[model samples]
Each structure stands twice: as C-alpha cells, then as structure tokens.
Target: MRPIDEGMPRERTLLSWRRTVLAFSIASFALARLALAESLTLAESLAATALLVIVLIVVISMRLYRGSMSAVGVSTFIVSATTFLLGVIEILLVLKD
Candidate 1:
C-alpha cells in the first residue's frame, strides 16, 4: 500500500472548502430574497429545497475531502454540480413564480 500525497491533497481539499463556502454564502443571500417575496409559492419551496441540498452537498464534500484514502477530485465535482443545480433551480423557481 502507498501513502497519499499529503501536501497536494490538502491544498486541493482547502480549495474545495473555499469554493463551498462561497457557494453557500451566495445561496444564503439569494434564499433570503426568495423567502421574502410577495407571496409564498411552490417556487419558493423548491428554491429553498435546492439551497438546502447544496449546503448538504458542500458539507459532505468537505468531509470526504478530509479523508485520507478517499478521492478528493470526485468530491469537488459533486460539490460543483450541486452548486450549479442549486442556482438553476433557484432561477427556474423565481421565473415560474
């Protein structure tokens, strides 16, 4: 068995964490606006759900990134995909409403 490249993996993991933090921050701000709209609708609920899923994905990615034997790249991809999905859903919900 071989040991992992400690420094590189840590750097990549740190980048993933930074990205997740930024994505979550943006989504949180957007969610506030969606929640405070004139009427409560299904669109708002869907947007909220998307944001929640993004947050969960980010948290899970970070956890997986920190593990020694796990692959960090895949986790990063998952995080990015979820973030994109969150944004798309938010847009769709807002437009639909």
Candidate 2:
C-alpha cells in the first residue's frame, strides 16, 4: 500500500478518538459542575471528589496527547471506571439518605 493509504486509516482513528475525548470532557465537566452545587453527605462528598478526579484526568489527557496511544487509552479507561464508581457512590448516598 502507498504511504498515504497507511496514514489515512490512522488519521481517521485519531479523529474518532478526538471526538470521544471531546464528548467525555464535556459530559464530565457538566457532571462535575452540577455535583459541585449539591449539599453533600460524606458519600456524596467523596463522589464529588471522584468526579473532579475524572475532570483532572481529562485535562492531563490533553497534555499527553502527543505521547502514546496506549497511555491515552489507559487514561480513558481510568476515567470511565471512575465515572462508574461515582455513579455507585451517588446511588449509595441516595439509599443512605
């Protein structure tokens, strides 16, 4: 295959990754912003903290963009897992209250 053909697939994949990052960043920021205004119980406070961590991860991801795709994918997974944990924390807080 030509050099241009090889780069085309990688370029498309990178574009898709950028879109995913943008979506995740927007969603995470909105969630964190809304969570900030809530009156908190201990669990809720921790959940808010986790949400903030995800926001931080998003910021760090931008800095590391030129590094490695593997590292970026790992960070994405961590943020996603943290998001899941935050959901669980919110659910428990609801049950506790």
Task: Write down the lDDT of every candidate, Cα atoms only.
Answer: 0.65, 0.59
- Which 10 consecutive residues of model 2 have the lowest summed lDDT? 34-43
Predicted candidate 1 versus true structure: per-residue lDDT over 13-81, tens digit per residue? 668677766767677557656755645664466556656766766666666656643656675676667
Could you tell me which residue pairs clash in candidate 1?
none
TM-score of every candidate: 0.48, 0.48
Query: What number of backbone clashes does candidate 1 have, counting pairs of residues 3 or more apart or in separate chains?
Result: 0
Model 2 clashing residue pairs (backbone): none
Candidate 2 lDDT: 0.59
- Stretches of candidate 2 above 4 Å error? 39-76, 86-97
